[model samples]
Target: MHWRQKVDYWLETLGDEDPLKIDLLKNLSNEKLMEDSFYKDLAFGTGGIRSVMGPGSNRLNVYTVRKSALGLAQYILDQDDDAKTRGVVIAYDSRHLSQEFALEAAKTIGRQGVQVYLFDELRPTPLLSFAVRHLNAYAGIIITASHNPPAYNGIKMYGQDGAQLPPAAVDSMVGYLEQIESELLIEAADEKQLKKSGLLRYIGEKVDLAYIQALRTIQLDKKAQPKDLYIVFTALHGTATKPVKKAFSALGFNDVIFVKEQSFPDGNFSTVKSPNPEDAAAFDMAIQYGKESNSDILLATDPDADRLGVAVKNDLNEYVLLTGNQMGAILIQYMLEQKKLAGNLPEDGCIIKTIVTTELASAIATNYGIKTIDTLTGFKFIAEKINEFKQFNSHTFLFGYEESYGFLIGDFVRDKDAIQAAVFISEAAAYYKNQGKSLYKILTGLFEKFGYYKEETRSIMLEGKNGAEQIERIMTSFRDEPPGTINSIPVIKIEDYFKRESLDTVTGEKAEINLPKSDVLKYKLEDGSSICIRPSGTEPKCKFYFAVKGKTAESANERLSELVKAVFNSTCDLALHSI
Candidate 1:
């Protein structure tokens, strides 16, 4: 159907009581806006649907939420007999309509006679993953946009293992979603009716208490983590405020300061320009709080609280934000050290990171007598590795991370847990302080031991359908007309994940990659630097990852700049900047 026809159909079918129906009528004259809204169905790919909240088939609303839940319910019923009674857990963050969307999903699933475990209030995404396993639910859903602007909201679907749905599962669910025609026509059972029928149950503190009990096992240091170390934390007006407070209080951290302005569950995220912890701007309030309180470290979690951002005080007494790569390297060394000291460092243990992450982490792992494994980008892949190792009893999954700030240390939660990361970093800060060294100094020490590694991630925003096509063309160009050299540096090897093959440019040899196919390209330079390019799975953007290593910090930073500029000059004429 044409985009205009889809808009007209929505206008015809939706009830007047619906807010989106009213919005459609009010904006009938705005063709550009209408075109963008009705151009296509909101994609249920890479977990679930995420988009601007509005009155179109392409936007996120009550109807889309119901439609997506309907798909999950049918998939559960059809895929496994046990999944029917196993039920699904529903949770939401602090975004606008998050709670409403959660309820919509619960009602939709309950209407299908599937039990639904809905949280009583907003919670972090990681908790939703834990609640699924805790309740033995068939699947989980979280209403959040995870660091996106206030105008957007999304649904992330999780499998029974508490990880995001793998591609095969996502494909099965999409088949069901595609069979449904009109989003406005999908039906949801009445909330009161579902509650009366015993298909709807509210879950809160019971699960929270269980999760906290599990958190106790994640503590690395059994002894005093330090009474003198101070911390400043900000939830960025999301769901982590209460949990973080509870975590710090439980960990015996009395010197911690929560950033008051950004600590509450404000959906708008009023105190910051962006909710993403990767953005240094989001740490402004936390830094102010840190300096005022003379804190040792500053931590910020995104809206959903699955990814963590950390800043440490340097000798200059200024709070410096650590990139995802930097923090990942720091955590690898710290966790392994504590485990070794405790005499529980598994010989078969292995740390996992995405191929785009820095090699410094691998070096750190080697220093501690552990091996590192690389997977395709995204935490779901890491989660898959966790499951694979447990099933085969091959390797102990110590930790997993991606350069985008997502990390997981314990298998208690299948996905990344910012709460766990915050606790772990706090312990590291105290351990270092006892030795009269700052966290920044420890990071520098790692640089000296291993090599100085620097990394930068940049994205080019491409919106709308046309932008998506452009992204595809750009990716295709790289695969077809490959760059033999970047900045006069020889491209010694190319790993094309989509083809599931790696090529040695000099030797003219190829090797198979034993991982799922993906639209990613990794180019290895002769100088030991690497570059990776992939389209963002969740957003209409293409991301570029650059990494460089040197004996000194100055050399690493300089080479990094030259490589980034050279990559752009040597390839497509696309603008890229640090996101």
Candidate 2:
């Protein structure tokens, strides 16, 4: 349909409540806006749908939400009455209209006579994942945009095992979603009817207690002197505040301080420009508190509370924010070492990390004689592996992490749990503090032993209509004509995940890749370095991740600077080619 027709359809479907819709409608009459919204429907990719909060057919709003839910409803109902009875669990983060979206999904599923277990209040994505298994529900839904800015929101679908829906299932769901030709015709149950029928139930504290209890078992160094360690924490004005702080207190931490301004669950996220813990500025308030309190460490979780970010006081007594790679490495080392000492390390235990994550973790895992599996960039893949091993498990799940601030310690929650991560990091801090070593020192020791590994990620964000096209163009170029060398290191191999093969750049040899097919390209260099190119599955951006190996900390810092310059220059060159 033409953009104007889609806009007119929206205006007829949603009247005055959508000012942004109307503005987009006015712009749709122009050639520009038409090309944008009419280009394509917001993609229901690997995890589900995520987009800016707006009224276009390609954005996230009531219409999009209903369409997504309708797909899920169709998929579940098609499985027969058993699936309906099994139903779905629904939870939301603290975002604008998140609760409303969750309710809409519940009603849509309820209309199909499916049971719906909805959380009574805002909850993290991991809890929603846990509830799916806890209730033996057929599926789950999490209303969150994760670390995205306030203007964005999303819907993530999960399978019965509490992992994000796999590719085949998502494809089936999208097929069902597309069957509903127009948004105006989508159907939902009456909220009162669903409630009165007893098919829809609201849950909260019981599930929270169960989740927290499971987290306590994952604590490796539980005997650390908690009273001697001073810790600072911040939720960055999102959903993790109460639960995370509560987890810390339950772990016997006596001197943890919270950054007051960012401790509450506020949808606006007033204190920071973006609630993402990946950015250094997001911890400004927490760092200030850390300084004042003379805390040993500072911790923060993103809006949905699935990803944890940490900063520690260095030898200079200045707080240095630890990279996702750094934190993951520490957790892997500590968890494995402790498990080995306790003689509880499973003989067949394994660790998992994404293809784009730092190789230092693989080195650490290898040192402990533990196998490490590499998956695509989402935690869902990691969770999928955990689920694959649960029954008659040959390899017990040890730990899993990605370079994007997401980590999971145990199989308690299938997805990342920052509340649990915070508990483990506090325990690790206390244990190391008693030994008179800082996290920074431990990191240095790891680098010394396993070769210094440094990584940097650059995201080129293109907003609105043209931005997405630009991102697509860049990805296509990389797939078609990859670089031969980067920073004077030969591009020895190019792994095309979409094609499920690794190509030898020089000899032209091809080998199959065992992971699921994805639209990602990774180039392995001769010096044990690598780079990955992928368009953001949830956002209008393309991300380039670069990793380099060095002999020492200073050398690693120098190489990282050089690698950044080279990568940015290459990106500029690639952009010019796209233009």
Candidate 3:
């Protein structure tokens, strides 16, 4: 149908139920907004449906939510007969209309004779992953946008193993979604009737307690002194406060101070420009608190509590922010040293990282005779690796992390658990303090020992239909005509994940990459630097990653800046200052 037809149909069909939607349709002056809203259905990528929340078919609303649930229900029914009996677990974060959407999905599933397990209140994404395993549910749904602005919301689906549904399964669900013609025509089971029939259940503190218990088992040093560790923590106005505080206090870290202004759940994320922990601006309030309390370290988690960010006191007594790569390196080194000291380092132990992550991980793992496996950018690929190792019995999963501040220390939960990361980071800080060292000093020492490695990521935000096309154009241009050199350094090789081929630029030989096909490109330079480009799967942005190694920190930073500038300038006419 034409875009105008879609707009007219939606306006006529949805006028009575949603007044806000009617207001949007009546405002004919905003032709661009109307066209954007009805141009196409919201794209359900590998992760799930994420978009601005609104009334059109291309936005996240009750209709789209119900359509997704109906498709999921159909997919589950197509499985064995017991699949519906196992049912699905539903959780939501503190986004606008999150709980309402969760209920809508539950009713839609329940209408199809499938059971529903919904959370009583908002919870983190990782908790939903844990609940799937704890309840042995057939699938899971988490209603969250994971640090996006207040205008955005999303839904993420997981499989029985408590991990995001793999590529094949997501494709199947999308196929089911395609069979439905109109979102407005979908039906949902009556919420009251579903409850009366015992198909709808509410889960609460019991599961939270179970998750905390699982976290306790992953603590490396239960006997370590935590009293002297004055830590400052901030939840960034998300859903991480209660569980994080409980876990830290239970572990005997009594002096942990909470950033009061940003402690509670506020969907607007009023305190910061963006809720992303990777951005230094998000840590502004936390840093102020840290200085006032004379804290040893500062920690912050994103909206869903799946990603963690850290800052440590430097020699000048000022808090210095550590990039995700730096934090991952420190955690790997700490875990290995402690495990080896306890005489528990496994001979077949291994760590997993994404291709874009810092090579410093390999350097640290190599020192302890551990193997390192690389996967695609998403954490789901890392989770797939963990599951693969379990079946093959070749490698024991010790740790897995990405450069985006997501980490998993144990297999208790298949996704990144910032609650666990917060605890482990605090404990690691305490251990270093006892030995007369700060985390910053430890990180510097690691860089000195392992040839100073520096990494930086720049994201160019492009929103709406035109922006998406521009992003595709940028990616296709690079893929077809690869760069010969970057910042005066020769390009030694090019890895095209979408084609699953690696070309040796010097010799003109092609080799296969033993990973799933993805829309990512990487350039390997002669000086051991790497430049990778890929569109963000969850957000409307294209990211450029740069990794460079040098003999000194100053040299590495200089090289990194030059490479970043070259790439940005050569690409589309993007703002140079954005980098």
On TM-score, who's better, 1 or 2?
Answer: 1
Of models 2 and 3, which has the larger TM-score?
3
What would the per-residue lDDT of candidate 2 be over residues 202-311, giving only the tens digit for each residue?
99999988888877898777766679889888888778877886687777887989888888888789889989889899989888888788888999999899999999
Question: In angstroms, what RMSD does candidate 2 have relative to the true structure?
Answer: 1.9
TM-score of each: 0.97, 0.96, 0.97
lDDT of 1: 0.89
lDDT of each: 0.89, 0.85, 0.90
Model 1 error, position 284 (Å): 0.9
Off by over 4 Å in 3: 571-579
Q: Report how far residue 469 has shifted in candidate 2, in Å.
A: 2.1
Error of 2 at 224 (Å): 2.7
Q: Is candidate 1 or candidate 2 better by lDDT?
A: 1
In model 2, which residue pairs have backbone atoms overlapping below 3 Å?
none
Tens-digit lDDT string for candidate 1 (488-579) = 88899999999999999999999999989999999999999998999888888898999999999999999999988876664442323212
Q: In model 2, where is the ten-residue run with the lowest total lDDT?
A: 570-579
lDDT of 3: 0.90
Name the best candidate (by lDDT): 3
Tens digit per residue, CA lDDT, model 3, 1-579: 887888778777775758646666577568877777778888766457789987677889999999999999999999998899999999999888999999999999999999899999999988999999999999999998987899999999999988988888888998999999999889898889999999999999999999989888888998898899999999999989998988887788899999999999988999899999998999999998988899999999998899999999888988888999999999999999999999999999999999999999999999999999999987888999999999999899999999999999978789888988889988899998999999999999999999899999998898877778778887887887777877778899999999999999999999999999999999999989998999888888988999999999899999898888887775543223233
Off by over 4 Å in 1: 569-579
Q: Note the residue pairs that clash in candidate 1.
A: none
